[model samples]
Target: MARALDVKRLSLVRLALTSAVIVLALGGGRALAAEPERPASQPQPTPPVPAITRECQTPAGVKTAPIPLPNTLRALQQRKKIRILAIGGASTARSGPDRGGFQEVFERIIEGAIKGLDVEIVNRGVSGELVRDAKERLKVEVALTQPDMVLWQVGTSDALARVPAQEFETHVGDMVRWLRAHKVDVVLVGIQYTRSLAHDPSYQAIRRAVRRVAQREGVLRVGRYEATEALERVRQGRQPTPPDPFATTEGSYACVAQYLAQAVTLGLFARRVEPRRQRPPNPAPAPAPEMAPTPPRPLPLPPKGG
Candidate 1:
């Protein structure tokens, strides 16, 4: 009786396990049958968004002629560094990197545009200085710094002082030639524009003088006057209220920096235009080779004796 009872308990446990297995198997089959098959959907790739570059943000009037900067380019290529000497009046006053200015903006633009390039800007700006004053200081600074390039923002103070246009031209032109002689490249940043000075004779004269010098010297010139004028016009059109002088001033500086970056980058890649050589006149086409006279073929044997 005891053996039979033990056998019965064993049989009951086995039956319970078997039923549990069958139930689980059925449930699993039902789950599989109830759920419909799904095809995996492939993800579509996203297109890259176009970057808004400084050039894209630049105003239409912010124009610059791409004069090649052989010295600066050479320095960049050799040392992976560009040491720029910035000298000017109020517009170019030295500022710390935290304080934004054209110099800082310029450095950022250039470094971002180029990989593995380092830019060091030495600012030597003195406010309320005339061309003569800055020129004197520039000579000293150039000697000490030995920079690869010189960024000279000029003409505003001289214009305000009512300096004679010819005198202004002479001072700037002389300094440019001197810098070139010293193997230092120069980019002339022209005067800042304002509604008050838009028609001022002295200011206009000074601006023209700078232009003439840049054209004659063949260096890059950032037309701050033109760019600012354009920006002002746009502002005037959009807003009826009086324009904010401070905002305009900031925009002017940003535009100047962008224009400078554009000019410098273009100059770096600009190829020197080699003067066309007098290609020797093609030697008169070799005299036509003389062909021996073809012996007169006897008339087809008179048509085979016709």
Candidate 2:
């Protein structure tokens, strides 16, 4: 009797398993495997960002103080355009990894950074030109182009030529003042830094002079020396390399351009304090007309009666 009960239970279990398999094979398998229906996702749109806000961010190893660019800002606001005259020595030359040159690269960056604004870069860079010579040429160029801003990359050649730092400062300061008088903005690009020349007095003096002039004149100054030194520090940390005395590389050029762009962007947004016009000392009240002596009137009346 126990054996019969065990066989009956085994038969019942087999029948149940067989039934489940048959049901799945028929249609339940398809139902279990099917994915639940879901609503289709709509594409999301990207928000537009202003060029000034987006591209004006300072990059690593670059820093600059904001200095007002009243003329350039006015040009941008009124004409939607800003003309830049890039004048300097060999560093400002049209030599870069990209044939477009660093000034061209600078132009592109400025235009991209400032939305709906056109940038015209007039490259007046002369290789081996000293600061004085460039200053003279700069005047002619300014007259011809009438640029809203003058990007002057100076001090490098002057320092190499051992020009007196005081003289360098005077010339730079004069040019900056002249540009301001002409309603043009000026940015002073300081001497390039190299490890070999880091301690050289003449080179360092010129660098200091550049800073002094920038401070006195209250114009934007791009401290290329600081920017390059910062880059050198970063590179040194990654892989120490022998210092090159004449280290004018395309990489450094691009890096300097980035520094310049940051300075220019900051300047563009700086507060403009217009110089107060001295109202001509209120014209001294014109002296009252001297009254012809009353005697003269009496004499005329007596003559008419006679």
Which one wins on lDDT? 1
Which lDDT tens digits does candidate 1 get at residues 218-274? 998988788777766666655554353323444456666777887888787777898
Q: How does residue 58 of candidate 1 score in lDDT?
A: 34
Off by over 4 Å in 2: 1-61, 91-101, 237-244, 273-306
Q: What does the lDDT come to for candidate 1? A: 0.79
- Looking at model 2, residue 290 earns an lDDT score of 90
Off by over 4 Å in 1: 1-59, 91-100, 237-247, 278-306
Score every model by TM-score. Answer: 0.68, 0.66
Output the TM-score of candidate 2.
Answer: 0.66
Candidates in order have lDDT scores of 0.79, 0.77
Q: Count the backbone clashes (under 3 Å) in each candidate.
A: 0, 0
